[model samples]
Target: MAYVINDDCIACGSCLDECPTEAIAEGDIYTIDADACTDCGTCADVCPTDAIHPA
Candidate 1:
């Protein structure tokens, strides 16, 4: 499964840099592109507010 960015996202850009596949996009709360996500969990690991999770 891909990782999903929840509403708790602060849009701090922390996960953006951590995504190896560049699946994350900038937005009001940020968004993870399911098709591009590698399910590596890197984004979730770097999320400051624990917003990213398996979808």
Candidate 2:
């Protein structure tokens, strides 16, 4: 499963650099491309707000 970024995301762009597959996209809360996500959990681990979770 892919990781989903919740509304708690601060749009800090921290997760962007952590995504190896370039699955994350910048936005008001940021978004993860489920097709590209590897489920590596790197984004979640680096998220300061812990907004990323498995979907």
Candidate 3:
């Protein structure tokens, strides 16, 4: 399972650095690249808005 950024995302960059695979990318709301995401949930732990979730 990969993690995804939800609409609740505030466009913060916290998750970007937390992603070990560098899967999170800047966007209208940050996005997690499913192919690169490893279900580590690092981004979720670092998310200020709790917007990162399993997809």
TM-score of each: 0.95, 0.97, 0.93
Between candidates 2 and 3, the one scoring higher on TM-score is 2
Candidate 3, poorest ten consecutive residues by summed lDDT: 12-21
Over all chains combined, what TM-score does candidate 1 have? 0.95
Model 1 worst lDDT run, 10 consecutive residues: 13-22
lDDT of 1 by residue, 1-55 (tens): 9999899999999888889899988989899899999899999988889999999
The model with the greatest lDDT is 2
- lDDT against the true structure, each candidate: 0.91, 0.94, 0.87
Q: Which stretches of candidate 1 lie over 4 Å from their true place?
A: none
Candidate 3 lDDT tens digits, 1-55? 8988889999978887777889888988888889988999888998889998888
Clashing pairs in 2: none
After superposing candidate 2 on the true structure, give the runs of residues whose Cα lies further than 4 Å from its correct spot.
none
Error of 2 at 38 (Å): 0.6
User: Model 3 Cα RMSD, Å?
Assistant: 0.7
For candidate 2, lDDT tens digit of each residue in 1-55? Answer: 9999999999998888889999999989899999999999999999999999999
Query: Whole-model lDDT, candidate 3?
Result: 0.87
